[model samples]
Target: MPKLLLLEAMGNTGEYILDAARHLNAEIIVVTHEDVHEDWYSPTLKAKIAEYGKLVFADFSDSEGALRQLKELARAEGVDGVVAGWEFLTPLVARLAADLGLPGNDPTRSLSCRNKRIMARAFTEHGIPAPRTVAARDLGEAYTLVRSAGLTYPVVVKPSEQSGSWGVSVVSDDEELADAFVVAQSHIFQMPHGIPLDPHVIIQEYVGGTEFSIETVAVRGAVTPLFPYDKFTTGGAKRAEYGHTVPAELDAAQVAVLQEAAVAAARAVGITNGVAHTELKLLPDGTTRIIELGARLPGDHVVALMRQARGIDEARIYVQIALGQEPVLTPTADTAAGIRFLTPPRGGTLRSVTGLGDCDAVALSKMTVPPGGRVRAPGDNDSRVGYVILHADTAAEVNAAAAQVLANVSIEVV
Candidate 1:
């Protein structure tokens, strides 16, 4: 069996990667910190690892030390490929892959895929259509930069390196800027692995438009853009992703426009192999602006959604690329899939959730938190109580089904 090494196995992507490994009959070994494995891993994830993979401990915070250990392990085990399981570890994965003479991204430009500060610079350099952004170390500096750059009110403020929309906020005026900056810089170290993050924060001109995500799979510098998806987010001062529908309602020409921009963004970031998840906004003027792109699989169960909607397993494709093999990109299904997050009405102890039984199109529903658990206020993605997956024959059908669930589902919190 071919051996594969994954840098970490604690996120949502880990389970999908494990399932893909089984499909390929590959022996997948997960390398992670011991504390992370013990603290962050769920029971289901732990069981999956035990049954389908092996575990190796390494301190990711010690970058040089971890690289040395991973290099030795990759050689000792004759590992055929190396992949990253989290956004924070993408740079490390690229470096490791290059060190082993395997197909991977350019280590020099890998940071641009993770850090917004560097990403903005890369977009500017490549002439990629993106928002005007400025990084700030303090609120005063952020204000100065915003005014100096001619950025008006109602701007976006977010951490340079965080993911999942954590610490992302929209400031309507200067008074809210201070608190937004504090929240953006709150998390200095990423959980589980304790990876240090950039202390600065990025404030950008708000790109007003409809948001969508397009994924691309690159093999040896050749890019193949996949179906675009509608990215639904909550409005107001804070942006939280509420859901997404695959094969976003668009004509052939519209899809072409998005695909071209996404491919350019991927190339600009030096993604010669693996996948790129590019989030862009379709403006009212019919132009597209890239919000950000990550050199990893589209998160939030998008891999599974793609499989259900298009009969394409993105997780499997990622593994194939890591193994330096051609990926199967043909679509076998003309369907649609969506996921809606369950956000409580208020921040309090969970009581009970009901009304899901009446929703017919819900293929699967999962509650992340149990009864009596403390839930946060609905401002960001962290406030989600659970999620429901929906699948149907078309995007409209899936969207209508999701609407019914969102309208009927009731969660009583106090």
Candidate 2:
């Protein structure tokens, strides 16, 4: 059995990774801050860890110190592989794996995968198709840089290092840009571990197109790109993802465009091994731009959706890649799956949510928020209150059922 070192199991991806470990008969040793493990980890994750894994506590805020501690622990544990359960820790994972003489991404360029400013520079240097982005330390600098970049209004202002679209906004003018800048600057650190973040903000020329995601796997520097999926995000200033359809409805040529962009991005970011969850935009001009990429598994229960749709267990594949084993990518089924988030009309105190009808295609419907919980407006992924997952024989059928299922649902918030 291969022993794996997982750096912080915090999201749905972590849960799925732990569950996959069980099926593979692998031993998992998770490293996280003690406080975060207590506060953020779900009971199910804790139980899974208790069953076949061990937990180690370290202060990730001190990156060097944490790396030292983890290195010693890795040696003692006789770990065979390392995986970043969170995107922010990709750099550290690279460093750890490199120090252990294990297969992993290039440690020197790992920061390019996490910091947008660095990632933009990498893309520019590599000639990767990406949005024209410039970084700034303040509003004045932002204005200067945006003009210098030859970017126009309706630009995107966001933190240099944040996930889930947390401080991202589309601004149409200078005043809106100023407002968005402060919001982006406010995200100065990552929580739970108190990890410091880049103080600069990125002012990027907005790419107008349909967004899609592709999951790519690499082993011993060889890449295998998966099918591109529909990343259904709401368009506006917020760009919150409301739904996702597996096997995005697109022709072979279109899929090739997305997958090529994704693979190029993964390679540019030094993702020589393990998995990359890449997001891209297909412009109206029959071209695509690399939006961003995560050197880890796809988030938002996508692991579940992929399995239901293609019978491709990405979670399992991720584990195999980390262990330097050939990933099992052959499809076991030909189907489709989708997930739609339930959101209130606006931000308010939650009162009630009803009218979720049990349609045949509906596989699971769940409310994550309870009554009286304060809810934010649907601005980002965090604003979601609940979600429903559906499945069918094809993407069209799944999407059709999704529309019908969501149309009948009602959410009431005071």
Candidate 3:
């Protein structure tokens, strides 16, 4: 069996990738910090990885050291493919794949896929449709650039290197820009491995309209577009995603537009192989602007939803592409799936959740953060206490069921 080396199997996508590797009969080796595996990983994740294949520990913060160690491990373990289960390590994934001569993206420009400033440059260079953005190292520079660029109010301020809407805010004016900049630059190191991150902040013209995400599977420069999904973000300064509905309710023309934009965005960032999760916004004028794209699988259990709705396993496709094999993109069903995150009304100790059994269409209900655990305010992905996954024959039904589940579910936070 071909052995695949995966980086950081601790996120939601990790389990799905493990399941996919098993389905493909591929041996899997997960590389992560030993402490992370011991501390942050759940019992289920640990057990699953142990049962599936080997687990290798590495220091992700030290990029060069980890790369060298991974090279040695790959050679010794006879690893045939390398994939990244985390978004922040996309560059590392490309570099490792290139070192092994495996199927992957362009290592030379892989940083563009991680850093927003670099990604904006790549998009501009490739003439990709994206928002006009400016990077600033400090507040003074941001103010100067904002005025000179003639950027209007309600612009987006975000960290150059962050995910899940962390440290992202929409500023309505100059007064709000400074606070947003601080939040954007507050993060200095990433979790699990303590990897140092870029301190710079990016200010972009907010692309106003509905937001959507598309997943693409690429093999040897061939890109296959998966079903697009609707992204529901909070309408406020902090654009935290509330949920997602699969097979986004869009007309054929709109779907085509989204697919084309997704492909262009993927190619702009040099995604030759593997999967890309791309986010876009449809403007009022019927045009679309690329918000961002990651050289990894979609989060929020999107892979599971896709499988439940259409019988298509995106995780399987990702592994197949990494293994230099053809991916299965054909959908067997036309159903719809939705997931709604249960956020606490206020930041406090969680008491209990009720009314979980009131929904008939609810397929699975999971409370990630248990009672007595402290919960943060609903601003980013970290604040979600639990989630409800629903499945139905039609998009309306799926949406209705998700809404009902959210309405009935009561989270008591002290």
TM-score of each: 0.98, 0.98, 0.98
What is the C-alpha lDDT profile of model 1 across 1-414, one tens digit per residue? 988999997779989998998899999999988888898899999998999899999999988899999999999999999999888999999999999999899999999999999999999999999999999998889989999999998899999999988999999888898889999999989876778999899999999989999999999999989989999998888899999999899988889889999999999998999999999998888889999999998888989899999999998999999988788999999999999999998899999888887566779999998999999989888899999999988999999999988888899899
The residue ranges of model 3 lying beyond 4 angstroms of the native Cα positions read none
Question: How far out, in Å, is residue 231 in model 2?
Answer: 0.9
**Residue 132 in candidate 3, Cα distance off native in Å:** 0.9
Best by lDDT: 1
Write out the backbone clash pairs for model 2.
Answer: none
Report, for every candidate in turn, its global Cα lDDT versus the true structure.
0.92, 0.90, 0.90
Error of 3 at 256 (Å): 0.6
Full-model lDDT, candidate 2: 0.90
lDDT of 3 at 219: 87
- Scanning candidate 2 in windows of ten residues, the lowest lDDT window is 318-327
Least accurate 10 contiguous residues by lDDT in model 3: 355-364
Model 2, 1-414: lDDT tens digits are: 899899999998998888888788899999999999999998998998998888999999999999999999999989998988898999999999999998899898899989999999999999999999999999999999988879999999889999898989999999999999999999687997889999999988899888999999888878889999999887788877889999899999999988888888888989888888888999998899998888888888989999999999988888888787888889889899999999888999889888887799999988888999999988888888999999999999999999998889889989
Candidate 1 CA-lDDT value: 0.92
